[model samples]
Target: MYQYDNYDQAMVDARVAEFRDQVARRLEGKLTEEQFRPLRLMNGLYLQLHAYMLRVAVPYGTLSGKQMRMLGHIARKYDRGYGHFTTRQNIQYNWIKLSDAPDILADLASVEMHAIQTSGNCIRNISSDQYAGVAADEVADPRPWAELLRQWSSFHPEFSYLPRKFKIAVIASAQDRAAMRLHDIGLELVKKDGVIGARVFVGGGMGRTPIVAPEINAFITEDEIISYVEACLRVYNRYGRRDNKYKARIKILVHELGVEEYRRQVAEEFAHMKALGLNPPREELARIAAHFATPAYESGLSDDLDRSDPDFALWVDRNVTAHKQPGYAIANISLKPIGGIPGDASADQIELMADLAERYSLDELRVTHAQNIVLPYVKKADLYALWKELEANGLGEPNLDLVTDIIACPGLDYCSLANARSIPVAQKIASRFASNGRDAEIGELKLKISGCINACGHHHAGHIGILGVDRKGTENYQLLLGGSGAEDCSLGTITGPGFDENGIVDAVEKATDLYLRERTEGERFLDTYRRLGMAPFKEAIYG
Candidate 1:
């Protein structure tokens, strides 16, 4: 929704020109693969197992129909006919050619988009609640702050190369839809005594070592948030480990220093930064905030949906959320359709979604970290028609947060770093639990699979986490239980030894069976797991 000004346009155009020259040099053999690795990575290009992968940033997960159309174009023209929407709300093209990298970026730049900082050590894309402005429970829209941070952090010389990659997420609702606590830095917009402020959470991450960030500052005035975040990053950049990549994330530093010491260090740095005038200017924030102004709504529109159609009713119940605006609802377009790939959208599907957004959703849509799309301002009266269009286009799946709605990474199918295949595992699991009645009976289970310990699938945050590993040159899978990626964030624990692929699927089914047998009335899988702990589930899986 935010349009790029002349300055933003010029900066992106210049970057495109620079990258084009770099790509040309690489193709001409003036730069070797080793020499081009960092350069390409800085632009969000990666050499995967089969081909080059390009990750494009979707800032704060907000995009206009125009931008979405461009993404569809890129998918069709440059890479494969489809693209993978990632857990970070970005999109990755798994079959990219090195020579087309610059051209793809240029096309992105035309729509005020880029791949910058999507994969580098510098601050990655700033994420926020996909339902930021429209959520009924929102205290404030977090996008203005997220946008401010994005502008401040892009190409910041001081943070160009940190010990490891950094991520930031902001949320305004009590429900943590953005997985706030799992980010390197998480900001919760809070209002106390009628004054808006930020509740800062620091050093949270997921990889080999998963950590739920501890609150560093319970309240910092909104005006001083930029200063506080800079202080925290400075502390991590100064003392975060450089010797070992495994120990380089800020979470490791927080664990080693203890939360109290880390808070103390951040406080000291905050004071120093404040004295040095690092706080962003109020005028600049105002300028960014202006772009996020609420859209005009028609008066006297009916809030009721014509859900006489049973199919429409089911979708409305499963995929729609209450909007703050009268007669409006936030509709989720589920990417996970039964046994289909979790987040893969064909170019035509993307274009269709863009057209629907333009026609019905105020020309704007938000990408969820759950790998879904949100038409945040759809009129209730138009729900059935929208559903019909989406259904015809294969974008309408009523499975929101269901068993078949699994989150999986590229794994060995694409990622060279992966030790095992995750896609097939996810597909198998989804297919196993494909029964609609079974999904409803099970209720609200999150199954996440990662090819390796890198945890890109966010396995550590799922209610049922599966990590694929290689044991004696054979693919094996490990199970983790009781994890969640919400406001009450918690890391999952591994259950004993790893199982083979079929064994893992059977083990998951067994766990589900145990949950169904043991659960009390209205207890979801996560609730049951938390109430009973991992003992019963562990015994059920292993026994």
Candidate 2:
């Protein structure tokens, strides 16, 4: 994890002071809601349907044990007893009081975390693979580059107030674990012929108009990434549509301009920036890289983890993944249970995870976009005892990439923009799937639900996507099929009409049954959907 330097600490402290004054002014009637809107948004504070929501950034989804403890403290002290982790790997407190926001920011700053860039139409938090440093397939850790982008983009005068919020994700390997294809800008670290570089993909995003990202260029040398990214942002800032909120994302810009023209424009702008020496300094990047160098690994461990305990075996089989190192494995903590809320953790649970990170694993933990916690480096020898501790803490759920591991949004419960309650919908689906014990039989599947078309749940990328809409005050869910979250990414096609809230679970069950019956053995729902198309699932779901 990157430690905050004096400059970083000072910036956060100063911002807190500024916000403290702003909050005071708003309370004193010196600033109205209209006046304080942008100010609050810039600080990651939102006035939700029921109360104020404060979103705190967990940069690149990394959290130290102490930092996690502080987040737990905040959740317990200020708002509800729990916090919701977002798809971007940030956390949101849905019941915060407007008067206590500055205090919350202050508390977070004490732990070297903040809400900066977590919201607003600006450069948001930089995201990377949760399995960055430990993944077996990784060529390099992408966090260093992510940190560099974080520093350069924070409060950047040139691009801070862009046409819309900009999201960037970097992947360090051939496998797209970070879902890079769904980001505004996706960078893949690559090595070709002994030369290190990045493959840049621009103008890829999801919203009302979803587009699978198209590659702009391949194997751009390491030195060129910054300038290339700057060029993409510059083009978006200049020509991205601002007249309509729906058309403001870079994806629409790319669609309107055409890929060839967009590519040409980006190259021209990048060349100009390069000539002007506007690229990020190599020395600065190296400095950031030093902070994220691989952690020291302790050699020699037993892989003979106790599999006698069914729970332990289930966890080992489902939650833990192979690590690049011989003795270590990555442990995934599933947030979705049979009837549990998705992406939510109570204050006590957060504290327990933090403690586990310091004790059993390295002092490192990552929040995944799938709304799960990942202990990226746990020794195989320590697996049994670690599982015991996790089980005691209620953090050991043995479902990874399964139907029960749903992705959902705050929906009407917290988000004012939401049309229906996503959490309940997610919980119902998870329970239904688990009770049947058909999740493993169905194989790896992604079920994502969004409150609205904004797609915060990443419903567009799910193998089975559900979008909730409020029709005449009645909640209805629309199902879509053939959606994928992998390399050959594609948006889901809608299946028939919207279903009533109760009908949704049945509809999903029908869809899954169709896939199970149609798919060959060992074929995942995504693979079967790709092979057969939407016709089969649509017929089963509607007919």
Candidate 3:
């Protein structure tokens, strides 16, 4: 994890002080709600349907055990007894008091975390692969570059207020674990003739208009990524729509102007940015990279796992992934327990995960884009003990990428923008599939739900997607199929008419049933869907 230096601490402390005064003014009636909207948004505070929601940034999704412990403390002491880990690898507290906002920011500042740039129409928290440094296929750890971008964009006067909110993600592997293409700017570190460079993609996003960003630059040298990104943002910031808030994202701009034209504009801006020496010196990146240096590993350790217990063995097979280092595994902790809310962990569960991280995972943990946690450096020998502890707690769910591991947003239950309730929909579906033997049979399914077209749950990228809408003042659900946020990116297509809340769950089951009956050997749900097309699934669901 990147430790906050005096400069970083000073910046955060100053923001806390500034926001403290802003909150006080609002409470004291010196500032009205209209006046305090942007001020509070800049500090990651939102006035939700019920109350205030605070989003705290977890840069590149990396956290120390102590930092994770502090998150638990905040949950226990402040709002509710749990926190919801989001699709962006950030965490949110739903019920927050206006009075305690500053105190919460101060508490976060103490642990090198903050709520800055989380809610505004600015470059939000920088995201990356959860398995960044430990993934076997990584070209390089993307976090250093992510951190560099974080420093470059934080409170940047030039991009302080863009036409709309922008998001950026970095990944070093070919497998798009971070949904790299589904970001405003996605950077993939690639090696060209033994020298690393970045392959840049621009204009990808999901909302009312979903798009997989087209590649802008095939390759920019290692030293030029930041400058190239600046150029990309500069073009969007210059020409991106300001009239309609709906079409303000860079993705929409890139769509209006063809990819070739967008590419040309970026190239023109790149030349100017390059001439101005916008790229930081190589030493600064090197200094940032040093913070993500690999941890020491015990040499000649056994790679064998004692999977004597069938239950533990099932978890190992489902939740554990191969690591770059020998005798190590990446153990995914599923926050989506059956019948429970997806991406949520109670204070005790959070604290237990922190303890597990310290005791078994090099004192470091990562939050995955799927709303799960990763112990990136777990020893294969200690797998059973770790599994036992997690199982004893509620964190040990053996479903990873299965139907039960759902992705959903805070719908009408929390979000004011939502049309229908998303939590109950997710809960019903998860409960229906919990005890069914069919979920494991339907392997590697990515099911996502969103309360509205905002696509906060990333429904546009799911293999099976559910979108809740308001039809004639009644809640309705739409089923979408064949979407993915992986290296092979595509948006899901709607399956004809919408259904009621319970009807949608049954519709999903019907679609999966058709898959199980028709799929060829070794075919995943997505592969089968892509092979058979939507007609069959639509017929099965609608009929």
Top candidate on lDDT is: 3
Q: What is the TM-score of each candidate against the true structure?
A: 0.99, 0.99, 0.99
Candidate 3 residue-wise lDDT at 259: 95
Angstrom error of the Cα, residue 21, model 2: value is 0.2
In angstroms, the error of model 2 at 145 is 0.3
485, model 1: CA deviation in Å?
0.9
Please give the distance, in angstroms, between residue 226's alpha carbon in candidate 2 and its true position after superposition: 0.7
**Cα error, candidate 1, residue 464 (Å):** 0.6
Per-residue C-alpha lDDT of model 3 across residues 97-129, encoded as one tens digit per residue: 999999999999999999999988899999999
* Residue lDDT tens for model 1, 1-543: 577999989989998999999999999999999999999999999999889999999999999999999999999999889999999999999999998999999999989999999987899999999999888898998999999999989989999999999999999989999999999999999998998889999989999899999999999998999999999999999999999999999999999999999999999999998898888888998899999998998779998777789988999999999989998999999998876888999999999999999999999989889888999989998999999999998988888998888899989999999999998888888888875377767879988999999999999999999999999999999999989999878899998899998999999999999999999998889899999988898889888
Candidate 2 residue lDDT tens string, 1-543: 788999999999999999999999999999999999999999999999999999999988999999998989998999889988889989999999989999999999999999999989999999999999888888888998999889989999989889899999998888887789999999999998988889999878777988888899987888888888999999999998789888999999998999999999999998899899887778988888888887788966666666778878888999999998888889998887679889999999998989989986788889999999998888888888888887877778888999999999989887899998898888888888888898878879999999998999999999999999989998889998878767768888888789987899999999889888888987888889888887878788888
Q: Deviation in angstroms for 445 in model 2? A: 0.6
> Can you give the lDDT of residue 536 in candidate 3?
91
TM-score, structure 3 vs. true? 0.99
After superposition, candidate 2 runs with Cα above 4 Å error = none
Q: Give the alpha-carbon lDDT of every model.
A: 0.92, 0.89, 0.94
Model 1 CA deviation exceeding 4 Å by range? none
Cα displacement (angstroms), candidate 2, residue 137, comes to: 0.6
